[model samples]
Target chain A: MYAWFFRELLPGPLWVRIILTVVLLAAVVYGLMEFVFPWLSEYSPLGDVTLEDG
Target chain B: MTPPLPRHADPAQRSVAAATRRQRRRRPLGAKIMGGFGEILITLGVLGLLFVVWELWWTGIEAESDRQDSLDEFYANMPARPAVSDGDDGDNDDDGPNPADFEVCYTLDDGTEIGCADHMRAQTGSEQIMGTVYAPRLGENWAAPIRYGVSATQIDRGGVGHYPNTQWPDEPGNFALAGHRNTNASMLGNQDSLQIGDPIYVVSYDGIYVYEVRERQVVLPNQTEVLNPVPSDSAAEAEFGVLTFTTCHPMFSNRERLIHHAEIVDFVPIGAEAPADLVHHEPITQMFYAGGAG
Candidate 1:
């Protein structure tokens, strides 16, 4: 399945396709770690330890 | 390739390719939607786990190292204390510390009683190490540096914070302190374990202030009275030095504040031998002077 997908979808040789896949995976992980997760964490109550009293 | 078979690639191969393409294109709408939703959920889960690791574990490691570095610098530059022969047995005949021995602060109106903390604070300015807090209940080696104010920069550095306006150690008022309950090294993570009469030692360059736990209370965050000269008794007069420990309650949650109050029972001068219970638990970096055991 992977071979078929890479062969049909990617416009490059096997080596180039492999490199593209790795770079794409890295980009997605970086985006989630650096941006998406941090924005979501602000809404999480786990790290919000401050008191509510004025 | 034997001359290309007109447009239909050999009936068998052509049929198989068409069937595969049809199956790929004919995925059910409900299945597609479910698959997309599942992917979203998995991504959310992975992100949540990563955040947990960052907040609970990575932050702790970073804060601990920062605090350790601060402690090392603070201790290394401390001046050597003057020797006093009578510090070892804990028996001094003077009604109060020798005026010539250390700077004294007459916080009360009488001007007779001396507050050693006034001297210590004067000696150690803002953002400096006010002292070292040792809680045997926390651990055999639980000692955190006490900085000047309560803020993320200070408390998050893996140490407790001393209220700026509150009384200093040995002062005839409350020496209030604050620390994190969970994140940033959680200096006071186990503060609730302190039992009544448990000795809480505050070690300064000048001397050690020993406070005995007398009570514990949970209060609202807005209740500033807990830090008053006399905790929860704003109008009541203060007679002796007291220590108060404040932290977020319920461990990981911060819906309430946990407070522990201790009364000063003794003061050990710089030259005195260290307290037996606190001897084993030294700072990560030790700065021993030629004149005293501190």
Candidate 2:
């Protein structure tokens, strides 16, 4: 699957493709860290420190 | 296998042979679909691991910096003490300042005085830094800024949060606080290590309210009576202050809440000398004594 992305989907030569892959990977990681993970953690119990009035 | 190729076969013929082999090796439609699914599953698995790293490690990095910034702001804004020599310290065995010497720091909406514990009410949808908490038993240099609310905006910043509904330190009721136990800097990660008689110090704008641990209990998350003013006794009038620290129990899980209850044993006003047993963090302790004549 990754081979297909690298060889066919990316519109670049070998050097350019390597750079693009690194940039894309960094973007994905940044998105996950800044947006997805925080949103997902809201549903997780590990960070639920507050006690609800019962 | 039909016949041996010439020593110098045509390059075009060899290329055709390679293409045919590749065609033969092509997967069936079902296999192709299954392989796609497998790839997706692997990606998801990697993402799950990344999430764990983000939760346990990355979040702490952000929170620790936030905690430091908050502490810096609190110390910078700390009120300077007025020079006044109250003769009460000469004869008293306690070297701490007289609570009466400090002006009232909080009052109810109706203007009823709440005394000198530097009580700051948590506003809805916002947070306020109320103080800093120091526990020698937790760590030698362990101090987390205490904030007004226990929500993500507060606790996620690597600080214990005061329950707005609960009483403040030195008040005649349960002064409850909540903190993350295993993630977001794990402010109270060592809560289970607290033994009976361990001192927990809360240094607010007005003074430091010292509490001695009396009990530790693990209770269901829904068992919020532990936060009551007179814990487990809603009907009784609270005679003395109780400091309650609540965190997710069993580390890395929120199945229950670990609660440590401590009774208010001493109060050292901001201008007074910190108690001998107080956690000796120089900059932090100095903030309390900044305005003092001493």
Candidate 3:
């Protein structure tokens, strides 16, 4: 239960924190993998009008 | 440093050295007692404080790691339901978990093979070697992984060694558990305190079972027969629905296995949905975190 996910995840115990941390980090990575990172191409300007926090 | 701080220097330095020598010779009342005998007590007090910190902070870290690993192993290995075999119409489940994902393992009485999942739900306040032993005889409602057992290492780094091949929780027989002799964690930490008929329990993913301490058995680790579900290790011999809990005697090391023998009385459902009693009955909140309100 106690993990480094304290920043989010379950609100009790060190394990919860760790688990939550890892879970959220994984979620973010998953989002980036599926959404933001896929649309990169040469003609498309690197600078975008909007960028959701990756 | 500077040629051994001048023994006799300028007036101020000379005075300071003289005062230093005088202070060494003029032991204060407290210092006078330091060498007489109190020093040993003071030293012991400091050591005890250090031991307390080690018991608390570092032990908690180790416990947390073990618990996390245990849970991971459980989730990774256990199937949603028990595994099934051929000719069983896919209903047979040999290796999967029942609903709550409780994975069981076996170990010897020497305290080796402390499972990685031991630290899964560890309370982080004090690293007092603690955990509950789920005894079948203690009934499903009475068991919990309370802080039991003695701390073998500096960080209280240890595991609850399964008494090899004892009856499983659901199996008809006694399931024994042993932890450290930690007073705060109690149980194994305080093996001497467990009295006869005291209510105990095992908090498992499947359910909770209430047990009553019936007797104590002081035996060497080699007397493995006591842990046998049949008391003889013969599969043909059915179990006696008993529970055996053990810990080190007189604290410190495993000089002897202080044991509590009990019997199961009730088997409460843990997280089963089909059983209406699971919804209507009092829910066991401590075992699984998101288990309440069902």
Candidate 4:
């Protein structure tokens, strides 16, 4: 299914398609880092420590 | 059956054809399994690299901008400084009034530089930028805002967070702070680098609290005594204001915390010349004025 989709959706020759795939992967990584992960970390309680200090 | 060959095919072409045939041969089951495992390992490695970039680079970028915005807002809302005329006491210095004469001012032990503890004692708020901290040992350009809490909302903004229950800057107690070592901006990424007698300056709206590193220790995250007025010396009475900086230890791990303790030794009020340690750091001086209430 993925092979058929790529063959139909991707443009140009094999080298062009390879470059396009790499670009798409990079975009995915960037989106995850820029938005997705930050948003997810908001719910994390990692650094949320309150010390009723002595 | 004989396979068809090109009319111009030569001995070299025949060898190439044989090599192509050999390349088409199927791999053994064990080899195929190993290749699949190798591909998975490579995929995992790529994912790990992406995570590292997200943690170090992207987070730093976000936090820096957030810190800048917070500082801008804090500076904009600062109350104007009250005018103090130079008296005819034969000392007409342009560096504002002498702390000895002013009720709001308190001098350090040297009786020269004024303390800001009295000024900062009146200000308090949550998620607010208290002041800028400078540690030359951290780096020449190292300065982080002291926020009100040790949560994602504060620390993730690329600055250290002051423990809410702890004492304020120049206060006669422990003014403890926490930061990340490998995430966000990693404000205290080099907390372990601070050595004995190294200076750590905490600049509030009132003045710069100059602290000298006295000791370093690693402790568990839940060890609350480290935030005490005397720090781990619970039975001992507090004599002077102490500063504690905490961060995740071992880099990229959080199993333990690295803590550094410094004692407030001096205070340089606004309009006065910055301390000697800050002489080489002009940007800090610039930032101090930019955020100054005066």
Q: Candidate 2 residues B1-294, lDDT tens each? A: 536556566877765665666577688989888888999999999999999999998899999988888778777776654344555556544444544566654433445343465344432334467788888899887888887788888899988888889987646789999998889999999999999999998877767777899999899898889999999798998877889999998888898899999987776666566666553655555545433344
Residue-level lDDT tens digits of model 4 in B32-146: 7787788779877987677667766778887888777775665565544323434465755654444344333334555544454564554446656788788998898677877
Task: Write model 3 residue lDDT over B1-294, tens digit each, in one string.
Answer: 234675446767865764666555765777566565665687568655544444434345555565444434433432142232233465535533344343333322342221123432343233332333443332332223333322232122333433334555555554655554542123244445667877565544444455667778776655656666654464655433567766655454444556677766554433323222222223333222233222
lDDT (Cα, tens digit) per residue for candidate 1, span B1-294: 334445646767765665676666776879778777887798779767777766676668877987788677666766443334454667666423332465554433434334366535764454677777888888987778888877566777888888878887766788888887877788888999999999998877666777899999998777888888998689988887889999988877877789999988776655445677765544311322223432
Task: Rank by TM-score, highest first.
Answer: 2, 1, 4, 3
lDDT of 3: 0.44
Each prediction's TM-score against the native?
0.73, 0.81, 0.41, 0.73
Residue B229, model 3: lDDT of 68
Better of 2 and 3 by DockQ: 2
Q: What is the lDDT of candidate 4?
A: 0.71
How far is B214's C-alpha from truth in model 1 (Å)? Answer: 0.8
User: Which model, 3 or 4, shows the larger lDDT?
Assistant: 4
Off by over 4 Å in 3: A1-54, B1-161, B182-187, B232-236, B251-254, B271-294
Best by TM-score: 2
DockQ of candidates 1 onward, in order? 0.33, 0.66, 0.01, 0.22
